[model samples]
Target: MKSWRTMSICLLTLFLTILMGCSFSQESGEATGSSIILEFSEIETITDAGVQLAYDDVHEVKKIDNSFMVYKKTASDSHLYLGSVRDKQLTEYGFVGEETYIQDFTKNEESLFGRPMTLITGICGANCVENYLFEQVDGQPQLILKLSGHVLVADLNEDGEKEVVMMQGSPQIEIHVYKRIGDQIMKVNLNEEIGLTNSVTYNSQTNVFEMIINNETKQYRYDTDSDSLISL
Candidate 1:
């Protein structure tokens, strides 16, 4: 009986030791996964001065975070750079061709998944504007969304998360709305009764997206429960 008890105690100790080892490995992996190391430059030298008459002329340095910075010039057909402060590497994110320039770049106050985002606009053609939404994922700059025209991010349906609204085509008759579903972005279906119009507006009173066509109004409210839009 004494021998059996001693063996049982030894087995219990071995099991506990293995379990603790597994737990420690998992914790270490989680910590390492949370921190992402990026390969960036450590110098101010930039390639493709980008339509600038003068080489190495950069202005308007904006700091997005401790690691990322954006710099651009105000001259016509200028370039924009997204650089890493820690690494000192610069990437030209703005337009470069002739008859084009960096229009505007804005950093939204809201964040998703503990990562901040920036909206950038550049003119590519006579009537074409390229809109890009950049987010930091795993400590690196990521281009999450690119659109033909400009985009607006707002809680159009008064939901907790904001939705993306994009106006496509020349007359802006084709308005598209995208919402976040699970880990993907999906387009929201509009009510069939809603007519096609370029005069789309958000109605705060009803918490719905509205459009006015030929003096007639059509409203569509997003049903969070159904993940669809209901005509109001």
Candidate 2:
């Protein structure tokens, strides 16, 4: 009985020490930040050229500090996937024209029913562009990228370019907008959720953008300058 009790205490002390050591190391290592990489076998190569091209396009956009909203094509039994990479790395992932499952590393969470994905360019702020997954109304999944409000306006300045935006959460607040000129995307913020029925059209003047809620007649105005509503 005495020997067993001594052994138990020894084991407990060792275990506690290990746990403390791990915690300390992780806290210090966080200062270095983390990097995400897609692993491929050395002898393996991309088989689908189309998929490869799509990935390449997304990758280029990301390199310029842009975000993407991509969806997987699950409609009619078709499989499509899209992703964005920056500097030969997987920065943002998405699906094009469909719905997809998006994994979030920051939150370590996954959700369903994301919106249709789009590629957001010219978003200017550092760490402005974000990535996400989309799930369409037809029960499909996709990926999405986003840019912050500051980044959007700064990038799209002095150009007659439509802004692209990125937002967070299920409802998608705080958007960042972007546009492409030649090869680079000019970005801006299209903030303040446009309120309306279901769908609406945006004219260049008077109202630069428009929105509609789910099947309603109420139209709303979006202001890009201060990230607020101009009218509703």
In order, candidate lDDTs are 0.53, 0.34
User: TM-scores of all models?
Assistant: 0.50, 0.23
Q: Model 2 over residues 1-232: C-alpha lDDT tens digits?
A: 9999999999999999999999997754322213111111121222322233334333121122232223333334322334443344342333322112122112212221121233332211233333332333343323322322222222223234444333333234434344343443333333322222133343434443344333433333443343333444
Off by over 4 Å in 2: 1-77, 83-92, 97-162, 165-196, 204-207, 210-226
What would the per-residue lDDT of candidate 1 be over residues 19-125, giving only the tens digit for each residue? 99999977553313222121212222224322222224555445666654556656542445554433333554444222334334444544432236666555555
Count of backbone collisions within predicted model 2: 43
Q: Provide backbone clash counts, one per model.
A: 1, 43
Supply the global lDDT for candidate 2: 0.34
Error of 1 at 71 (Å): 7.5
Q: Which ranges in model 1 have alpha carbons more than 4 Å from their true place?
A: 1-104, 112-115, 122-129, 188-207, 212-215
lDDT of 1 at 148: 62
